[model samples]
Target chain A: MVVTIIGIGLIGGSLALSLKETGLAHHIIGVDRSPDNQRQAVALGLIDEPAQDLTEAVQRADLVVVAVPMDAMLTVLPLVLDAATDRQTVIDVGSTKALLLQAVEHHPQRSRFVAVHPMAGTEYSGPSAALPGLFRDKTLVICDAPRSAPDAVARVEAVFGRLAMRLVYMDATAHDLHTAYISHISHITSFALALTVLEKEKEDEQIFALASGGFESTVRLAKSSPDMWVPIFRQNRENVLDVLDEHIHQLQHLRELLHQENYPAVYQQIQQANLIKKILK
Target chain B: MVVTIIGIGLIGGSLALSLKETGLAHHIIGVDRSPDNQRQAVALGLIDEPAQDLTEAVQRADLVVVAVPMDAMLTVLPLVLDAATDRQTVIDVGSTKALLLQAVEHHPQRSRFVAVHPMAGTEYSGPSAALPGLFRDKTLVICDAPRSAPDAVARVEAVFGRLAMRLVYMDATAHDLHTAYISHISHITSFALALTVLEKEKEDEQIFALASGGFESTVRLAKSSPDMWVPIFRQNRENVLDVLDEHIHQLQHLRELLHQENYPAVYQQIQQANLIKKILK
Candidate 1:
């Protein structure tokens, strides 16, 4: 397969590496708005060539992977699919799906595009941060599959399956809602936690000195780039807002429980929270 | 050196193992209110024998290590100090320090007791979860060391230093305050995050299926034992409330940013959050 991966950053570079390692893509073309990123992707062996011509790359490629930030996907995704022919498959590896899918819902080439979100990534980003086998044993949620062409869906499944990802099918709306609970909320909470502690650090000297691995693990997502997350929050605004209301309510309730000298209730609430262990395990 | 470890759970058991491994405790005695924990400690080679009599154990031991829950430490710390001789050094490894330190402030044998919190642990508990190197390279916060006998403080340092722990000194008030920002808030935020997601999962099927390592890391502290954490929160209520208020305020601010579509401001806030990398690293 000849593949063109737009973005040429973390997710794009990683997918390029995985496709090449699995022999799923014989030739990989790198596409990025940044010339430096394109050069880095090629120099790192993530792609066979850097494509200066977007249309030419999409026309010759058997599969086009759009792995750009969510905000950019609103415009970039439709443009990439516009260059798609019936025989050429296009897919997006963005975090949010509903808005991106809706943007190209009426396009004549809609059937050529598949919505794919491989539930994998680290806090790191860029071409240098890419690693092979990132999606192995991870879930690849193929959203709005029924809207895509049969062959396009099949190609997506085959590619992700070759990379050993477990595929989950969901409608775009439900996909956004569930991700708001799992991925989106996690990042927001981490950012808030970091801000809260940083606020305290300004007044306290030894505050961060006492931080341990447990503290670091919980706050690690704070280091995630806002360039990636701010757009996600914007695109999935309604769902993110709904979850944020509940999250803020939960924090306030826990605070009240702690404030009222209700130790047993606080204990019960923590025990209740422990139920997540069953699902997480 | 004859060392008796009270309440052989995760911290206690791990300390016992490290003391034995480092040849710091020539004869380690296990003391627990629960017979099963005593049996587990001895059976797991965490200690040489189980001490059935508290007075006898304290009288014969060269060092007495108190590793009970924070709630129990109020009563047990006074009892241990009452049994303390000038030759025997005592320490309590509770998470919170202010209330515990104040509980025995006027006691006659207060100089014999040192307040030490080895700033390390996992979510798991019990003697079986104990590992030998749990304290290696971890911080050992010594609170109210000045209130204790100079010999007692030195002995505590020597023991933890032998276990390869980095030593830090703080007063009881500052220790609780710092931990509220760095450690305690992380656990509370995690419990709240877990509660928020678990609550959402009830109304939405397949909600947790998208959870990846990122979500798991942020919610990991929810699995911490309530028996251990509830008392710490109750004791450290003031500082926890102060930090919890700021955390909630930050979340609300981020929510409003998303609601208003202020992408630039949201991005800037997260960039500020990324500043935690300096202190965390």
Candidate 2:
């Protein structure tokens, strides 16, 4: 099948590489709003050809994969749906699925669309950061899959299977809530950690020299791009806020334990926290 | 020099291996309360011999290194001072400096003590987790060097240098505050993050399989020992609380941005957070 990946950057470019490398797609074409991204994606062999002309690209495509920033997905998705043929499948790999899912809820060709969120990425961004096996051994969350045509759902699942990703089907609302706890809050914490240290600590050299593996591990997501993240935070607002409140409460509990010099209580909490080893691979 | 390390585990056992392998110490002796740790340290060749008695271990030693859980340091350090001769020096490699420093401040042999915090180690612990050159190229924070005897400080610095550590000098209070920001809070965040995800998500296998590098990096410290971490938190209570407050406040700000659908504001905050690249090596 011919797969046209729109907004080919880290996620889209990676998807393009995986589909082509796994022989899951016959031809991979790129559709990016940035002229530079289109040029770069092609230069880096992320796509067979740059689909600078979306209308022409959509005309021949059998599958349309939207891998753009969450905010931009709203604008571009409707246009793609309007132009999609009967056989053409539309899917989105946005972090926030509920907003995008709601936007296309009543669309005429909504049955052709499958909302997906592949839980994989690196701190790096742009077309040059694309890696062929990026999706391998990751989870591909398909939200509201029942809304899409059986053929379209199967097509997306098959593509993910080819890349060695495990598929989990859930509603858009459930997907958003799970991600807010497991993924979204992590990025916020990392960004806030970076800001907290930067605002208080004047000596850059000291932070660099003294940042242990623990600090690096916790704050590593601070390196992620603002363009990709801002929309995700805005789109998944309520869930993110709820999780953030819980996290702050946990920190406050730890602080109270410290203030009281309650060593036994603090140790018990850490031992409980160590239960994370069960969930962590 | 003959070096004796008490409570041989991750930090102490690793130091023994570095000393023996580098030929920095003629004979390394280990004294641990646990028979398992004692046997493992000797079997792993971390020490030349394992001493059953702490008093005997220190009396014959030229230099005694106490590497134990933070709670036990206060108890172990005083005994070392009482047992050591004028020719011998003692040092404790504990995460918290203020408490340990204060406990030894009034001792007649106070000048013989050197307070060191080596910012190193993996999440794993115990003698088997010991690795050669674990402290190499890592920062070693020496607290209140002026209070230590010149020769004692020189001997400790030379030992650290032989193991390829870069030494930095700071007072006890400053060391605790800076470490709270860089190290202690990271553990608290990781522990809470693990708890947060565990409470909300039910699929254990899915969480393990789908834990990407982002999740691994964010929750790495959850694997640390509660026995080792609890005391550090208690010792550095005020400083840890201060940093924790700032971190929670930062998360609240991000939540507000998301709540308002302030995409631009969210983007700008993350962009500023990306400045952590400047501080992280």
C-alpha lDDT values of all predictions = 0.91, 0.86
Per candidate, the number of residue pairs that clash is: 0, 0
Give me the TM-scores for chain A across all models, comma-separated: 0.98, 0.97
Can you write out model 1's per-residue Cα lDDT over B141-260, one digit (the tens) per residue?
999788999999999988888888889999999999988888899999999999999998888868877989799999988999999999999999999999999999999999998888
Candidate 1's C-alpha lDDT?
0.91
User: Which candidate achieves the best DockQ against the true structure?
Assistant: 1
Predicted model with the maximum lDDT: 1
Share of real contacts kept by model 1? 0.87
Fnat per candidate: 0.87, 0.74
Candidate 1 ranges with C-alpha deviation above 4 Å = none
Off by over 4 Å in 2: A203-208, B201-210
lDDT of 2 at A2: 90
Which docking category, incorrect, acceptable, medium or high, applies to candidate 1?
high
Q: For model 2 chain A, give the 10-residue run with minimal summed lDDT.
A: A201-210
